[model samples]
Structures are given as C-alpha cells and as structure tokens.
Target: MKKAVGIDLGGTYIKAGLVDENGKIIKKQQFPTLAEKNDREIVLTQIEKSIEFAFEDNIEGIGVGTPGVVDDEGIVYEAPNLPCWDKINLKKIFEEKFKKKVVVENDVNTIAWGEYLFGAGKGSKTMICITLGTGLGGGIVKDGKLLRGGKYSAVEIGHIPIDYKGPKCKCGNIGCIERFVGRDYIVERAIKGIREGKKTKIYELVNGDLDKITPKTISDAYNLGDEFAESIWIDVGICLGAMFSGLVNLLNPDTIIIGGGISQAGKILFDTIEKTIKERAMKILSRDLKVVPAGLGIDAGIVSAGALIFQE
Candidate 1:
C-alpha cells in the first residue's frame, strides 16, 4: 500500500500525517510553527521534522497545505498568518531536503479536495467547500477536478463583493462577504452587542472579559438562548447563504460543504444558511444541491494534502 505524507502549515502549529489512498491517516504528528524565528530555513526544518516523525518510511510523496496563495509550482506568494513566509519556494526546499516529490496547494484548496474525494462530497461530481473561520476561504471542484483560475486563485468566494460600500476587508476590498461573515466579524458583532448593554447571557458567559470572546463563545451563548448571539449567527448564516447563492447559480454544485471553527455552531449556523440560500438562490440551481458540514474537521488539511498525491 503506497502512502503519502501530508502537512498542514498554520500560523501557530504544523500538523503532518501519513495517509493511505483510502483517506485513512496511519500516523500523525504536530509541532509549533515557531514563525517568529524570522527564517524560512528554520520553519522548513521544523516542517521536515514533523513529516519525518509522521512517516517512518515508504512515502511516495509529500503534500503541503499552506495558508496563502500558492502557485502550481508550489511557491508561496504570501502567508498573512505566517509573516515569515513571503514568496517562499516551498516545493523546491522540501524536495531538495527530503529527496521526495512534493505537491503544495492552498490550505483551503486542500480541504476542499479532501472533502470532495473522501468526506461529505465523496460522491459528488461538482462541489464547493467553503470554510468560515478567521477569514472565509473556499475551493471549487468541478467534475472531480479542482478549479484554479487565472491566478490559480479561483473560488475565492470570501472576497466576492456583496455590498459596494460596506466594511473594508483585509484584502483591501470594500463590502466583501468576508468582512461581514468571517469569524472576527461574528465575534465583533457579539462583543459590540454586549458592550451596548444588551441584556443577554453572553455577558455572563464571557464574564465581562470581551477579549476572551471568540466565535465559539458566541456559539455557546447562542446555544444557551442568548438572543443577541443568536441574532449574530443568523446574520452570519444569511450573509454566507447570500454569497453561496451566486455560486449555486454559477456552478450548481451537488454539494457545498461548510467547514472550519465557526461551523461547529451546528444547526444554528446551517439552518439559517440553508434557509437563506433557498430563499435567494435560483430554484433550479438549488433544487438538488446539498449544503452540508464538512466531516474531516481539523484533519481536513492533512487529509486533503495527502489526496493531492494519493488521489487518482
């Protein structure tokens, strides 16, 4: 059985695993990113160590899921999360260091591919994987192939403009859906509500420490029937669904798999998203589309990365 090594490089940690063609992770290891070291060489070394630990031997290739724009040649153009990585040639470094074939792709793309091949989208011919977290990232797969547009950055649904003059996005755009529905936006709205003395359970949950308020905290507050938090999630769902409506019209995918930290909100998130999409999307386009949550969870990156090398 041929095996592959998969690495998901993030700002805070590096997760690597040995995975088989069946999407089964045989071995796994993790380590801190140590990005502040300010040297790409050091970061690459740590990554190699994690890969080595995960795969003792017999790895056909290594696949890396990075947090930024990556060219088909496996070069990272920019990684906002990891400031140390800027236009780094990740594929060359890994291949030279380990003498193994390497494949590098954007982290969200990896996750989307993983889901399409082995998770919720296993049997779908066309699918869109949208991850809602710190920022919204997406990948679109058409007929089992990942779509890389002109700049190898297609399906960047998060940046799709919803409002012409809304809030500013980190991408320097105005009214991008990401600015309104991203994890930070969700938490920010909740914190604002609390600060305004909205009599809600969120105040009790965070104990006045607004800094500790996270998307998860807001989700928990929503589950506890906090009206303000619930409203925030509803708005997030509506925004996401509205964005997806355009995708539904364009691709008419069999599934749209929603993933990432905020997805853990479960029905509170999905219900609203589904409702909004149904109300907004074209009837024919949405009739058969399934909007589902991702199954791979945190392992999505590693599994998807491995698929880059292992999938037929």
Candidate 2:
C-alpha cells in the first residue's frame, strides 16, 4: 500500500505522523512549538526535522493541516494563534525542503475531511464537522468533495452571526458563534454564573483560583450534578443548535460530526444539541440528521492530513 506523511501544526505543538493507505498511523511524534522563541527559520527547521524522522523510501507525499485561514493555493492568510503566520506559502516551503508533493489546508477543514473519510461521517453523502475548542470552526463535505469558497473560507461556521447586539469577536464581527461557544466564553460564562451566586462546584474545584478554571472544570461539575454547569452546557447546545439550524436548512447534510475539547461533555452536552436541532431545524431537514462525536479524537488531524496525500 502507498504511504504518506501528515503534519498538524498548531501554536503550542507540531505533530507529524507516518500513515498508510488504510489510515493507520505507523509512526507519530510531537514537539513543542517554541513559539515564544519564534523565528520563521527555526520553526520551519523543527517541522522539517519531524517530517524527516517520519520519512521512508515508500512515502510519496506530504500533507499539512494548520491553524489559520489557508487559501486553496496553500497560502496561510492569517493564523490568530500564530502571530507570525500571514500570507506564507507553507506548501511551497515544505515541498521545496522535502522535494515531495505537499498539500496544506485549514486545520478544521482537514479534520472534517478526516472524519468524513475515516471517522463519524463515513458513508454519508454530505456531512458537516464542527470543532468546539478555543474557537468554533467547521468544514463541510458535499457529494464527496470538500467545500472551499472563493476565498477558501467556506463552511467556516465560527463566524456565523447569531445575534445583533451581542459582544464583538476579535475577528471584528458582532455575535459570531465563537463569541458564544469559544472556550474563553464558556469559562467566562461559568465565572459569571458563579459570581452571580449560581450554584456550581467550579469555584471550589479550582481552589478559588478563577484563572485556573477550565472547560474541564465545568464538565466535571456537570457530571457531579452541578446546576450551573448543567445550565452552561445546555445554553451552549441551544446556541449551537440555533446556529446550525440555518446550515441544516441550507445544506441538508446527512450527519453532523462534532470534535475538539468541548465534545467531551458527552450526554449532558449532546442531548441538548440534539434536542435543540430537533426543535429549531425544519422537520424534514433534521429528521435523519445524525449528531455524532468525532471518532478519531486527537489523531484526526494527522490522519486527515495524511488523507490528502493518501487519496491522491
């Protein structure tokens, strides 16, 4: 079988894997991004070293999934987390450095493709995959093709405007989905609820350290039957469902795959999202829609990036 190399580049870590045609990762490794020690050449060198460690004679191609808005032409327009990345042709850099066919895409898009081909959305003709992490992001695959808009920002569900008078996002948009569902906002909501005397275990769990509070704190508290925690997830699900209703109505995908950190909320989170979808979306549009968790977990990025080469 053919083989390829996949790289998932993020702000804190750079991961690389050797993958076979069947989506099995034969080898994988990760390294610190050293972003604080940032230098374009140094960062590229680290990535090169990882790729080289994974390379072998049979490796035919390479694929990368990065944390930014990547054009179809493999240029990173902007990566919010990576302060130095802007209009860089990463594909060219990797290809020239490695002398292999290299392809690069937005990280979320790669995750969606990974799930569609090998994880939750497999066998579906059309699918939408959303990742709820520090930010909200998504991608859509329709009739076996990934959707890339003219600006390579198609299906970027994070910026979908839901409220007119809501808080402004760093992206300069009012009421973007990320403003409501992002990690910072989720924690912010929990903190707000606690300050207002809503009953929850988050404060105690964090040992009175608000800065240490995280999404996991909220999830753990919810599992412990905390009212405030439960409310937060419920509200998140409702907002997500409301935002997704418009997509379902327009795209009519067969399934929706959700990934990233917040997906771990399990039933408390998914049940509400499912219920809201049923309530908000049109009957026919949502009747058979499957709201499923991503099956690959952390490996989704590596596998999907490899898929770019594996499929070719």
Candidate 3:
C-alpha cells in the first residue's frame, strides 16, 4: 500500500499524518503553528517539523494543504497569518528539504478532492464543497476531476459577490456571501437581536456578554427551544443557499457538501439551505441536487492533504 506524509497547515496549528492511498490515516499528530511570532522562518520550521513527524522512508512523497492561493507550481500567494508567505514556492521548498515529490494545494481545494475520493462526494459526478467557519472556503469537483484555473487554484467560491452594494468583505469585495454568513457576521446578528431586546436564550447562554456570543451559543439556544436562535441559523442558511443557487445554475453539481465548525448546527442549517436552494435555483438544475454534510469528519484536513498526492 502506497503511503504519504500529509500536512495540513493552519494559522494556529499544523496537523500532520501518515496516510495510505485509500485515504485512511495510519497515524497523525498536531503541532502549534506559532504564527503569532509572525516570522516566516519560524512557521516554515514548524511545517518542516510536522513533515518530519509524519515522514517515513517508504512513503511516496509529501502533500501539503495550506491556506493561500496556490499557483500551478505550488507557489503560495496571499497566505494569511503567516508572515512573509507571499510568492513562496512551497513545493520547491519542501521537495528540496525532504528530497521527495511534493504536492501542494489550497486547503479547501484539498478537502473537496478528499470528499470526491473518499467521502460524501465519492459517487457524484459533480460536487461542490465548502467549509463554513471564521471564513468561508470552497472547492469544486467537476466530471471526476478537481476543478482548477489555468495556472492557479481558482475556485475561490467565498469571494464571489452576492450583493455588489452590500457590506465590504475582509477580501475587499462588497457583499460577498461570506460577509453575511461568516462567523463574526453570524454572531453580529445575535448581538443585534439582543441589543433590540428580542428576548431570546442566546443572551442568557452568554450571560449578557455580547462579545462571548458565538454560533455554538446560538445552536445551544436553539436546542433549548429558542426560536430566535433558530432564526439566526436559518438566515445564515438562506445567505449560503442564495449563493449556492447561482453556483448550481453555473456548475450543475449533483452534490453540495458543507463542513467546518459552523456546520455543526446540524439539521436546521442543512434543511434551510436545501429548501432555499430548491426555491431559488433553476428547477432543472436544482431538482436532483443533494446538500449533505462532509463525510471525512474531524481529521478531514490531514486525510485530504494526503489525498492530494494519491489522486488518480
């Protein structure tokens, strides 16, 4: 069985694993990214350490999933939280260090490929996957291939604008879907309701500390039978579904996979997204569409990173 070292690089931690070709993780561990130091070399050393931790003599190579826009040659651009990361040739760096073949891709794109191969999207001809959390990231698998641009990982789905005149996103785009559904924005909605005295359990869950309110708090409130909390997830789902409706029209994907922290809202969120997409997208395109949770679970990143190298 062929194996590889997989590295999932994040702002706060680097998750490393030894994975077989079948997408099963044989062993895995986590290391702090130490991105707070804001030194590129420090972060690089951390990644190297992660690679070493997972490396084995018989492994085929290393696969890295990093947060950034990665070009065809594995040159990373616009990496957030990692200082001086722009224009770094990650593939070249790691290959030289480890003396092995290396494959690097944007983290979300890696996840989409993993789902396509071993998770919810396994049997689908076309699939779209997104991770909803502090920020929204997405990838697409079309016709049994991971979609990519001519020279870069181009499926930047989160940056797609839903409203050109609405609030500006952190990416400098106005009214991107992420601006309305990202973590802070979701929490902002709950804060507004509390300030307006809407009388909900969210306030109680946070003990009046508006700053402490999170999507989890809202989920907890909804579990306690709070209608107001349910409203927040519904609105978020609507925002996401509205964006996905456009994607469905353009891509005609058969499956849409949702993951990451906020996806834990479970039934209410998924149901609302499916309902809204059905209502908004073209009937022919939306009819067979299935919105499902990601199948890779908590270790998706590590497994997906390995999948990058094991692609058929």
- On lDDT, the candidate that comes out on top is 3
Q: Rank the candidates by lDDT, best first.
A: 3, 2, 1
Where model 1 places Cα greater than 4 Å from the true spot, the runs are: none
lDDT of 3 at 201: 94
Of the two candidates 2 and 3, the one with more favorable TM-score, higher being better, is 3
Lowest-sum lDDT 10-residue window in model 2: 33-42
The all-Cα superposition gives candidate 1 an RMSD in Å to the true structure of 1.5
Question: Cα deviation in Å at residue 124, candidate 1?
Answer: 0.5
Alpha carbon lDDT of each predicted model: 0.86, 0.87, 0.93
Better of 1 and 2 by lDDT: 2
For candidate 1, lDDT tens digit of each residue in 19-115? 9988999988789888988777789889988988876457889989898888767778768878889888889988888888888888898898899
Model 2 root mean square deviation, Cα atoms: 1.3
Write candidate 3's Cα lDDT for 1-312 as tens digits: 999999999988999999999999999999999999877898899999999999999999999999989999999998766767889999999999999999999999999999998899998999999999998999999888899999999888889999989999888879999899889999999999988989999988878899999899999999999999999999999999999999999989999999999999999999999999999999999999999999999999999999888876
Which candidate number would show the highest TM-score if scored against the true structure?
A: 3
* lDDT tens readout by residue for model 2, 208-281: 88888899999998888888888999999999999988898998889999999988888878888889988988
Model 1 lDDT at residue 289: 83
